[model samples]
Target: MAAAAGPATLPAVVEELLSEMAAAVRDGAPISDEHLLSLKFVFGSSAIQALDLADRQSITLISSPSGRCIYQVLGSSGKTYMCLASCHYCSCPAFAFSVLQTGDNLLCKHLLAVYLSQAMRTCQQLSVSDKQLTDMLLIERTQEA
Candidate 1:
């Protein structure tokens, strides 16, 4: 008998959907309702909150001339959390507890907001120098320390 393959992980599924959404955006095509439904079904409340955050224009994409990008998402609590989508990292407590510590969730709502805002082309973009970006990271780390 053939061995059974494991099901795709939630992170992998989310990545696939995000890729499709990005491609659609690149092609100037609207994201299909089915895709949105799939996202909502997969992510549940996180997805719903992310969609709301994106719609509210609470995400900012800060980019350096060298092409590195970071995201800042304003939480419902009115605090901004730094999100690095490439590394799947967020400075939110939910991310630390749920995603990193307990591993109960693959991502927090802030990361979802970043991904959704990015895919939907809804993020506010700001360009700065590489040094400035580095400084921002250093400041964030210092604050955490």
Candidate 2:
């Protein structure tokens, strides 16, 4: 008899879905509705909220000429959160509590928003100099301190 298989890991499932969206973008084709549905099915309410945030144009991609990129999301509470998609980091309380501290969720809604915005090509893009990017980061850190 064959052994039963367990459920797919969250990271693996997310990576696979994102890879499909990325491939669609690379091929100059629109992401299929099925793909978005899959995201909703996997991520649940967070996916819907993320889609709403992305549709509202609340996510910004700030990139420097040197190839560093960061995401800024205007949350529903009118607060801004910085997100690093590459590292799966979001400067949000929910991220700290739910994602990191409790480990109840794989990602916060803000990070999901960033990912959804990027995949849908809906994010507002800003290009800044490397020095400006550094200054922005410094200012943000100073404010947090």
Candidate 3:
């Protein structure tokens, strides 16, 4: 019988595959079936939905003049949450549990969406005032209606 992969193996494999996919996309090459299958298997259904939303321009990423990469994801609930790519963090519960606490590198949908958007070179920007940033953070914690 074949031995199972070690803990570090999976992340490394996923990283390599994602990099290959990104490179193929940048080169305008048709992505291979193996790459697509690897992506689907690694990221699962939620990430696919996030990618679709990103393709539809539902995810908005903001880049400050200071070189900060912040993202805003509009969820199906009609609410927006922030994503910090530099920190590998998001203002959503899925990120908290799936990425942070569990230490899973897979990341939340918002993060995945931002990644796909950046890889495809279709990321957009939105201007948010400092006050809005504060409000957004507050709302993320409280989830106010």
Q: Tell me, by lDDT, which candidate is best.
A: 1
lDDT of 2 at 88: 86
lDDT of 2 by residue, 1-145 (tens): 9877764344777888987897898789987999889988887788888889988999999999999989999998888989988778888889989889998888888999998787778899999999998998887777767
The 10 consecutive residues of candidate 1 with the worst lDDT sum are 3-12
Q: How big is the positional error of residue 116 in model 2, measured in Å on the Cα after superposition?
A: 0.8
Candidate 2, residue 59: the lDDT equals: 100
lDDT of 1 by residue, 26-68 (tens): 9999989988999878777888898899889999999998999
Across 7-126, the per-residue lDDT of candidate 3 in tens digits comes to 432257766876787898889987688876777888888667776767877777765445444688886567677887765677877887877789764778787777777766667777
Q: Return the lDDT, model 1, position 14.
A: 80
Q: With candidate 2 superimposed using the best TM-score fit, by how many Å does residue 90's alpha carbon deviate from the native?
A: 0.4
Better of 2 and 3 by lDDT: 2
What's the distance in Å from true for residue 78, model 3?
2.4
lDDT of 2 at 87: 78
Clashes of each: 0, 0, 0
